[model samples]
Target: MTPQFGHFRAESGAGPLRAPMARWMIALVVLLFFSAPALARTAPDSFAELAERLLPSVVNISTTQTAEGQSGIEVPVVPPGSPFEDFFKEFFERNQPRQRQRRATSLGSGFVIDARGYVITNNHVIQDADEISVILQDESRIEAKVIGRDPKTDIAVLKVEPSDKLKPVRFGDSDVARVGDWVVAIGNPFGFGGSVTAGIISARGRDINAGPYDDFLQTDAAINRGNSGGPIFNLQGEVIGIATAIFSPSGGSIGIGFAIPANSARPVIEQLIKHGAVRRGWLGVRIQSVTDEIADTLGLKGVSGALVASVIDNGPAKKADIRAGDVILEFDGKPIDQMRKLPRIVAETEVGKAVDVKVWRGNKPVTVKVTVAALEETEEVAAATTRAPNETPKASIPGVGLAVAALNDRLRSDYGLDEDAKGLVVTGIDAGGPAAEQGIKPGDLIVEVSQEPVTTPDQMAAKVTAARESGKKSILLLIEGDAGLRFVALRLAAN
Candidate 1:
């Protein structure tokens, strides 16, 4: 019997082949219908709309500086046998001027942040420039005066008198920007104004060692020379960062660029505009990163927070009873995820404002109320004091793990200490003792024990015994090392 070519029958009249084929086709169609939107959402159709809207606010910055220096001339290399080499060298040398004064021009990028012609750019771009000019999108050039410049953050605020209200861009919350979020950079690359590039945020909180506040947003955008001080925008066309630097070996963009987050720049910019200077809060303490060894010694579960190395006398931290060897876990309710984060947080806080500081002390958490102070530009120098020489003999504190002697001329010469240094010289230390674990070396000078001056071994030993008798678990020793003066808290070993 002949069967139809297009149709098949199931065994025992169970079903026809067309029904199953029809169901499979329907399922495929449904999947395509739902997935069409997902495929379309992968990337934007074009960045034209966003670029057009943001270009008006972006400006090209041109700076000219009067440089007075000698200009060097390089002689072109020629074949050894070339007869004209000597003649050419002599002619160039005779004509070359030894010293000259000329105008050096540099180019950069910036964005208008206010309609009254307030612009923002990197401080390095206009540094030392005798004159500054801003070129708008329409090619209108306007001279700009420096409102303020902050070298620490590398931010500068400029003012220009435009004929009309200028286009300004607003800052977006860069804290919420994720690593893979799309970003657009508008800048004047290589003096070409109104240039645009797009990429995703490669990483966040990148420290390039540019400044004390080194938090930067790293991106893969094609940032090059003249792109410095430009704005990095998010998908909503809001400025999330300022393009400040690039990690390029060839002086060109290699898909690795860094931008200062808008969140960090906003406060600095506001202060620059308002007061022409930044007023940063200070805690007056020398802090170091909490290492694994330090964390273990402090009985901490994790290696997080900043470790207090020394506290400034009469400073906010000292006034609050925050002692040396305390690990600052949080500042102003913000978790200090790392040591570098604490300085930026404290600096951004308002001066004279009392904030709760959570620190890890003696294997426990302690909260102290500290009033932040205004950070001074000048550092405090410790005053040198003269102490009468003590004739006490050498003494050993067995539990404390150190043998000390008077700071005599012999000991000073042997240890290479300063001649005028007055302290108890540590002659020997137990390698496996608590003092050694706290990085105490044999040549370390014990200047003070529990805030009392100790010029001789007997004085230090007495202070240690007194501290132990008072039920103190640790004794704070002010030590002078090769680097400088610092404080070390050593656990009191059982007698």
Candidate 2:
């Protein structure tokens, strides 16, 4: 960084001794004033003390994966009646390919969360391992067993029966950690046990799509392969985050590392220790972001909150009368300023506890009481993919740039829509129109226009006309496609 300085001068002529002293004091004051901000970002003198204290608590995790595989000793293919055929057959008899159980070992890093022998590491570390071992700083290895693990957050808690009390580090308040704060990471990178690296917190609340609960803390710390599940400590030596992933193309640390915030991982860890699984609060609603265009169509002051696409059948959201198109503004007393924040907030809510959910409906805020339910861990059937239809539609909707038609039995079969589906089916979309720009495809079903049901193309056109005549720049549309329901806002200016 470029150095910044301020100029200051002493008052003209006083006592000879006082004049020089005044200038020195004035310069000192100005320099400090100009340097305070940079001083706040200054790096620590050394991380040696912190690393030395933390190394004992951080451990190296070794996992052995035993898998059945055929040996690679290929038998030679000799031509019939060849001169060396007999020799080749005898040589290949003893060296025939055979099935073998191969044992593969991998190394990862974790920390001692409890002295009674509870270790914290990434789930992927010992996912299918036959044997797990934890190595401390003094090179002592102890056989460990998995207590519980949460694959969603990539966190796992292991149990190791140690003869002596283990050194453990407490979790720090990750919410109090600000971006640009200094952080230290101690882990076993590339099998180098107890390696320490230092960097600043680059960002927070990063959603890398790793899982539904993806509130990760990003740092520039040099975390590499064996660094997964390692502890990222603040200057006070408290674990503020757990290193889980890195953004690199070369399979090495490119200075972009992601860690699970201590505050976010704490509840999951505690639940795993108590119950073998995590019982997360579920609102049972499929949601999407309220984009700028959607905000304009809904007459919202600003773009915020998660837009409800579809409430699960007979789920908590449906029981609470939270319909599709409702924007979840606040949950349980916490304001949801962004769409992604709602999921994490809702999941952290206590299951079966009734909470007030403030939603945006009919151009106004409406609060509803909802009892959060435990999320059921089940696999959902994959929806079929959609493509443009070769056949033409019954009618074309004007002003909205959609060639929509009244849904028929034949169109329903072509689009692979539900047998009991309602509303208009999009047979064609204008290539250069507003609908195409907003990702309105040919096989999608238009369920609602401006929060009102539209059964036919003419009704959709009428809704578009009403929105345009009402001086609205855009019209809101709820579309149901293979990917599920989503709200789209198309501009009406081209009409």
TM-scores of the candidates in the order shown: 0.74, 0.87
For candidate 1, the 10 contiguous residues with the lowest summed lDDT are: 3-12
Please list all clashing residue pairs in model 1, or write none if there are none.
none
7-37 in candidate 1: lDDT tens per residue?
A: 2323223457567775565567668876887
- Which segments of model 2 are wrong by more than 4 Å? 1-42, 73-98, 385-393
lDDT of each: 0.87, 0.89
Q: What TM-score number comes out for model 1?
A: 0.74
> For candidate 2, what is the lDDT?
0.89
- Predicted candidate 2 versus true structure: per-residue lDDT over 1-495, tens digit per residue: 553333323354456766676667777877887888867766778988888888899999999988999777776787999988998888878667668888999999999999899999999998989999999898989999999999988899999998889999999999999999999999999999989999999999998999989999999999999999899999999999999999999999999999999999999999999997888999999999999999888777788889999899989999999999999999999988899998889888889999999999988999999999998889889768656465863577676676888887888777777789998888887888888888888888899999889987778888888888889889888998878889988888556
Candidate 1: misplaced stretches above 4 Å?
A: 1-41, 69-99, 379-406, 413-442, 446-479, 485-495
